[model samples]
Target chain A: MKITCPSFKYWYPRLKSGKLAANDEQLAINHLSTCEKCRKAANAIEALIEDKIQPESDVFFSARLFARLEKSKPSHSVFIFRPVFAYTLLLSLSLFLGIRLGTYFYYQSSIPSENISISEEYAIHSTISGLDVFFQDDFNE
Target chain B: MDENEKFLDKLQSGDQQAFRILVEKYQPMIQAIGIQMFERSEDNEDFIQEVFIKIYHALPNFRRKSSLSTWIYRVALNHALNLNRKNKWKKWLMNGLNLIGSNEQAVPQMPGQIEENAEQREMRRLLNKAIQRLPENQRIAFVMTRIDGLSYAEVAEVMGISEAAVDSLTQRARQNLRKHLSTYYKSL
Candidate 1:
């Protein structure tokens, strides 16, 4: 029996997973079956993968991170900030309403001034009754 | 409070214990990625810490648009990559040294024959080294898939990329490794 290359032998599963095509798997299997060295290489790859680990934790690190974040003032300002936000919102609405009401009343009062001035001109333009009588005598003469 | 919401509430309130819980629960995941993506650095732990810190502060603003873990993972991955870029020159120099150093000694292999019963301590070390050499995107994807064992969709969420992108990343990473090992492969 021919010894296959270990790496090619190892990639067999990956091939089965469709990550490697049939041709690639065949080549790997062929080499693995023929080469003992390749088999060992494949074994090593397998060994390596089986040993992977997650990162270790340092409790102190978290403590310090918390300390830094806590001591960091920029983020804390948001706590008191929400109320201020609400207050400002109310303030803005009140100001807007007050300005709108004032403008409405002011404009309403201003319109009558134009009517008063037109009536004053109408009074002045009325023909005097005594002037009409004098003009009547002149007419008779 | 459900786990995520409670954690978020505390995080928003600046609860230190809550932060600790978050860190403790997730540090392993973050550290695994860091080790895989970067060579040994004294600053790695700091980078991980910063990642968590950012998550803690940003949690309040985090609309539940995504899961908390996914958001945290994204933060961790981005921080890890940023650290990787900042320390690239240093990593390159160390990699050169490692190449020269590896020539003289074949690292010891784990001795065990049983499934999950074998001493994987050493093999794990080698795996970490190999993962560290992977390109940034590949390393992150590999870490998410191989180390964290997250589904492709979850990995996509953490990566802010499509699932297709994650799949491609893993494939490309494997190809890169295959290329890197071509000489060793041919020799074998």
Candidate 2:
């Protein structure tokens, strides 16, 4: 039986590369000898395979790539709060609060109770005097 | 540790020199991919830079399961495929707009104006178009195997497919390319 074009196509490369078994190689070779179309197709396939585009070369490619990398390198200076830093912050805040509250209470206790009572009495007297003046103004009017 | 692992360690530790060496070593491979994927040299250059940048960002989290080359191939291929898809969409949209806006056809190239090298360039362009028209897996397999000269096993590893699968894909790719080239050649 004659090999179909598709079968020839599939096995042609294998035969060329010597990947096919001897029997398969013989079969492909026999087919190629008789089939003008497959032969032309094979030539075209080889030409296509050989016709690779040359890769353009830049001598300064590495330099430019590195320059770009250097330019675009993300900044590492962003503050990342570590557990230690967080703990230290918490400890400092607690210490500050403790000191502030302690100082407030100590100052509160340090002022004599009699002085506070005197200030309260003065505040009440001042309010009374201000009210009396306001009422006297109304009466005068 | 092996050389790849050591190099990876240095890369992970933010060693710029290691990064330079890595880029120097792999630039050609990445360029090959870029050149295969893009038509314009500038586009290839930009694509290469983008691939390297992606590799740079991805290195820190790399689990070191695959060889660096394989991983790089995977990344380069993925990026090229995505860029190609976007470019195809853009080209289609532009072509549609052109169709609507003007009936004036593009000027044909004069035979006298064609240089000796023009035929080769035209053939290469046609071949690239044929390759681009290939299905994703077949194109990848064919390009990796034929253009980049990767072995079937290596291509399979990069593509995450069995070696036999790569062989089949590449066979199909070659068949398709041959068909396309034959049709083009006959038309001429």
Interface RMSD (C-alpha) of each candidate?
6.0, 7.1
Worst 10 residues of 2 chain A by lDDT: A50-59
DockQ of all candidates, in order? 0.16, 0.10
**CA lDDT of each candidate?**
0.63, 0.72
State the weakest 10-residue window (summed lDDT) of model 2 chain B: B103-112
Among residues 3 or more apart in sequence or in different chains, the pairs in candidate 2 whose N, CA or C atoms overlap within 3 Å are none
What is the C-alpha lDDT profile of model 1 across B1-188, one tens digit per residue?
A: 67767767778787767767777888767766665555454465677767876786687788888887888888888787777677677656878778544522222222232244233434444454566688777888877887645678988988789999998998776655544443244443
True contacts kept of each: 0.38, 0.18
- Candidate 2 lDDT over B1-188, as tens digits, reads 88767878999887988988888877866776775666544567788898999998898998878988899999999999999989888778888778546423222221233364554556566667777889999988877776434677888999999999998887788767765665555322
Best by lDDT: 2
Among incorrect, acceptable, medium and high, the docking class of model 1 is incorrect
The estimated TM-scores of all candidates read 0.56, 0.62
Model 1 off-target regions past 4 Å? A1-30, A49-141, B1-3, B90-135, B185-188
